[model samples]
Target: MTRIASYCIAASALFLLAPSAALAQEGEATPPPAPEGQAAAAAAPAAAPAQAAPAKAEPKEDLKDKPAPNSIYAEGLGAGLWYSINYERRVIDDLGVRVGFSYISIGATVSAGNSSSSASASLLTFPITASYLGVRSGKHALEVGGGVSVTYATAQASNSFGSSASGSGVGAYGSAMVGYRLHPVDGAGFNFRVGAMALIGPGFNVFGDDPTAFGVLPFGYISLGASF
Candidate 1:
């Protein structure tokens, strides 16, 4: 019975010591499970990428100026043999007024059936008009207009038979015109106009009782002038 007790005690001690020796010889330990809080933090979804800010825009500038409406101009003019001086004033962008004076003189002698007659005629006309600008380009312009005129005229005649007569009168006139104006230097620069005009006046004599010399006259002009 004593031998059996001693053997049992030695067996229990060997079993405990054997486990400790095996652990020491292995030289490694099993890791514990991760904490719940640390695991949740690691598994959270990554933050989304940040968005960029938009850029600001810049403003634009104006390039040019609008002109004032009023302007004035004058020019030398001619149509056929008559020479004239022309004047114009624009009261608004598309509207204007003009005035001009034109003059012509001629002398002639006629002979037949043993008789001779010498005659001379002198004429003066003033044309007044209201115009519209139909075209407006940078430095070029076109216009059309119509108005009335006044004419003062005279004539003299003397035949070889010592017979002579003279006449003089003032008459009403009407006219229409189209003109193209050019500004060579700039918007308000040295300017000129090319135009066609027609004058119609009824028969009224100043020098004699016969009809006046200028009944229906058509003329052209190249005029030089300036404007402001």
Candidate 2:
């Protein structure tokens, strides 16, 4: 009976110690809880760098093609009956004024009964005009304008007998023109023009008795020059 009681006491003490050892081992195996802020930072991904916006581009200016503002040219059968040298200047973008000059002279000598006579005659023409240029397309444009012409004539005669005579006259006429023009758009270069013109004036008789009569005449001209 004594041996059986001692065995029971030892078995009970082992059962209590076994349960406490098992609880300590379980506690050591599990980790402690982390702080809330630290846990959130670890779980979330890093933010990407902020991106900059692209810059806007500005528009460029247009380079328009245009003719030069001044020109000098020789014209045939327009302002002058034969030819004239003309200079033109643009007061505005598309408006221009021109002035030109032309001249002609005649001379003759006559011998009659020992009394010789010599005579000379001269004509001077001045043309002044204002014109407008049309819209340019490439290197070409349409030109139109009108103006006036002034003519001065003089005659002188002297005989071997010492008799002398002289006369002079001034006349004015109206004129107009329409034509195509080719010129340099950017700089100095060759320029050309072709057009028709009309002149209204009094017809003058160089040899006949009647010196002035009303008349209208149609003419044409071709011009070549340099533009700047």
Highest TM-score against the true fold, candidate: 2
Model 2: lDDT to the true structure: 0.85
lDDT per residue for candidate 1 within 32-132, as digits (tens), equals 65799888888897789999888777765322222223344444443322556666666665577777777879999999999999999998978677878
Model 2 lDDT-worst window of ten:
204-213
Tell me the spans in candidate 2 whose CA falls farther than 4 Å from its real position: 1-64, 204-211
TM-score of 1: 0.53
Candidate 2: residue 176 lDDT (0-100): 87
TM-score of each: 0.53, 0.65
- Candidate lDDT scores, in order, read 0.68, 0.85
Candidate 2 lDDT for residue 189: 83
